[model samples]
Target: MSNNRRPTIKTVAARAGVGRTTVSRVVNGSDLVSADARARVLAAIKELNYVPNSVARGLVTNRTNAVALVIPESESRLGSEPFFAALIRGVSGALAESRTQLQLMLVRDQAERDQLTESVATRRVDGVLLVSVHAEDRLPGMLEEMGLPTVLAGRRDAGEQLSYVNSDNAGGATEAVRHLLGSGRKRIATITGP
Candidate 1:
């Protein structure tokens, strides 16, 4: 404990006078372990101050328990947009209930996009949540082709195929236009950004 060398599971098992599997089962809280072995492992863990490595456990379990949130916008835009902030809050709240870690990545151009694609390709995350829907965006298609689970905060258009979390922007626009027409506005225009 003082030599700066980390104590491993094997060391704990040795100190506990039990096999490695017994220690593993005890650490995992498996009922397969007898009462006596569990007690010994617990005592050894305390004596060594051993901590379980969640990352290694994730490797064995095939679940990193993490998801990526990709925002195709600059940091300035992210800070300025209330909608994006609200989207992040909702995403965070949902993930907190499920006990999953969220990794936020900003992809404003091709270079950043490529980096994101590589990270996903390496199986570093379980899934992706994309924001900033654009007509020319290629990330959703690329993520689908790479076999990674992907979703959108919104959609490029009415015909968007990816799963999305969105409100009724079209309906709201229609209601606003109707109100303007009834109020006798001479000219009304809806401008979706180009």
Candidate 2:
């Protein structure tokens, strides 16, 4: 093999004295290979530093092993909002366990929305996590129509058709008011924004 060429699965199989299928099975943790073959393949992989091609694997499996976190908001809002930061951290940590990649997408305008549509159409991502939903936004419907696995941070309204995870705002507010009343705070007011 050339010095500059990255080692392939074929090279690992050759070095391990096993077939390419054996190498693949071991790499994929299939538990079908013999102990001796598995050991040999592992050793060869370490020696050759053979990194599996994720793109090729995705093509073969028809899964990208990635999900898009679509935020239809401006960069300023994404940066300024603590909610977005926390949401991103939570999503990233969850996806880490599955060895899936997170693609952060911000769609603030028609052009950007079109780009997101194109990406979904291409099957570039396995699923989507949409945040900052509005009642009239058509993205959730579009994603549902495409048959892509999608989750939202919040619902568009009481009649939302898509799956979502949202905090119990009314319940939380009720609890807060109870606490304040218990503390003898007679005057209380609430503030909210979009």
| Per-prediction TM-score | 0.70, 0.85
Best candidate, lDDT-wise? 2
Of the candidates shown, which would achieve the greatest TM-score relative to the real structure?
A: 2
Model 1 quality (TM-score): 0.70
Error of 2 at 9 (Å): 0.4
Model 1, 1-194: lDDT tens digits are: 55698888999999999998898888776899989989999999999989877787677667777899999898998998788889888888999998798999999988998899888988888999988858887889999999988988878888888888887877999999899989999798766653
Q: Mind giving the per-residue lDDT tens digits that candidate 2 earns over 75-154? A: 99999889899999999999999999999999889999899889899999999999997778899999999999999998
lDDT of each: 0.87, 0.92
Give me the displacement of residue 168 in model 2, in angstroms. 1.6
